[model samples]
Target: MSTINCFFNTYQRRLEDLEKKLNRDQLLVADELTSAERELAMEMVHMGLLENIAQRVFVTKQFPINDFLLRQLVLGQGVYTGNTALYLWHLSDAFPYTIQLAVRMGYQVPKQRYLEWTENVQFKQVRQPRLEEDVKKIDVAKTTRKILVYSPERVLVELIKSTETDKELLKAGIQRYLRSPQRNLNQLLMVSKRLKAEKKVQFIMETLL
Candidate 1:
């Protein structure tokens, strides 16, 4: 091969190796890269081998850009709740238009200094003293990253408390949860009792199941 062809081949190999190293969950943050690796990453971005999702965030072409991944990228400190959590647990067929996140009452959302794209993310403050009551970490599908989210039982209770939620969607979510093989009726009741929604939850269950 000519010297130019040889150089191109070698460069291509290096990029491939770098891609492999950065493909963990198919997501990369600029801060995680060393100076030299940052240069290579930018080159990969230029070549369309990777995409710059935010200021310092890069994702491979295969990255699943869903609510879960977006939550991890932007609101790293909150748990998915409400409709977003319902969708994640497969209790609802409708995908949430905006990502719903729950954070501690006093928590401040991190400022996205480098986010180049706009995401419609809604953050709700969990005013309950025990904010982590039903929170759990779950693996994002097709990625190694585990995201914090409210358990299905907790989500059901939340739906009961929310006055603004769509009635049809709420009914659908409850029905789906009741029919799911993974449904834990005991857990659902426990969460509802703790949240002081036991009566409402029981009524919904009696009406539906």
Candidate 2:
């Protein structure tokens, strides 16, 4: 079955169970209940008029990004990279529907597995010179939760490496970032050298500056 179908089935079952429990005990003691159980109980109690509590039901959005990322984390850890990282950092205004991610080689998660979960995310393998140290946790815009992403320095190198296909758009993106007072030249230089994209990065910055 598709991932969405499976998740919906689980959700429906949980709601049905919650409804049954609420019916049995109007004053449900949630102190020992699971987080989900407690949340459903509260929603039933506070979300509407007292008469509607018995019929209280909630629906979920179609594959919300937050839920998708949480599931991705459960499957295997990953770091957002490329333009996706730039967008999350607020350096780029373009929003991407398909998020780019990199997972460590040791995770044993096949590239094909992400396809089974959702089409909105793409995954790649992070190779040598790109260790876990290169990634850091940061909040995605407007979200309270945090996610792992490549630092700006590593993101610059990744964009440089993609110049073959990305060409002009990336060049413009890099130029815009360089103009920002927040750009860290030293860190960029260090990571570019490690990624073997120092020369390319130097060339790009020189032309823009």
Candidate 3:
């Protein structure tokens, strides 16, 4: 084989090996790559073999760029809440036009970084005491990653407390939860008590269930 042809074959083999490694995990963390691997990863990014979704985060091109991946990008920054959380719980069929995230008060959101993926992101800052209440890690379908989101009970309480949420969406979410097999009235009431929204929650529960 010619020298140039031999070099090209070796490069293609290296790229294929790297692609297999990234595909197995679905996500590639830049920090985990060695100097040589990092260089190849960047080349892959340029060739459309991978995508640099966030700082130090790259995903294989085969991965879907849906809400799940978007949530993964902001994993440590905040937990998914509001309409977005409702969708995650399968309580609503309508995907939120705006991705709503709840962060602790005074937390600096890297808005520009998130906007690079999608323009419909809203950050809700909550008090320190309430920020982490009832948060849970739920698995994303067809991927190895899990995303942080408010539990169904907590999401219900938030819907009751937030004046910004539409009444129709709130009603729909409540009705869906009431009908779902996973519904837990006890846990719902417990969370309502902690959030000091028991009266409103009870009124809705009484009217619906």
Identify the leading candidate in terms of lDDT: 3
lDDT of 2 by residue, 21-75 (tens): 5444332334435678667666655765222211222222221345334534445
**Model 3 pairs whose backbones collide:** none
Clashes of each: 1, 0, 0
Ranking of all predicted structures according to lDDT, beginning with the best and ending with the worst: 3, 1, 2
Candidate 1, 1-209: lDDT as tens digits = 89999988877876776767666568776777677667888887899988876655778888767656554665446788999898888888888888788787987655565232225767688776667788887787766677788999998898898898888999999888878897999999999998899999999999998
lDDT of 3 by residue, 74-167 (tens): 4456788999999989888888888888878987766666665435668889997788778888876666667888999999898998898888
TM-score of each model, in listed order: 0.77, 0.60, 0.80
Report how far residue 205 has shifted in candidate 3, in Å: 0.7
Q: Which is superior by lDDT, 1 or 3?
A: 3
Cand. 1 TM to true fold: 0.77
Clashing pairs in 1: 55-114
Q: For candidate 1, which ten residues in a row score worst on lDDT?
A: 110-119
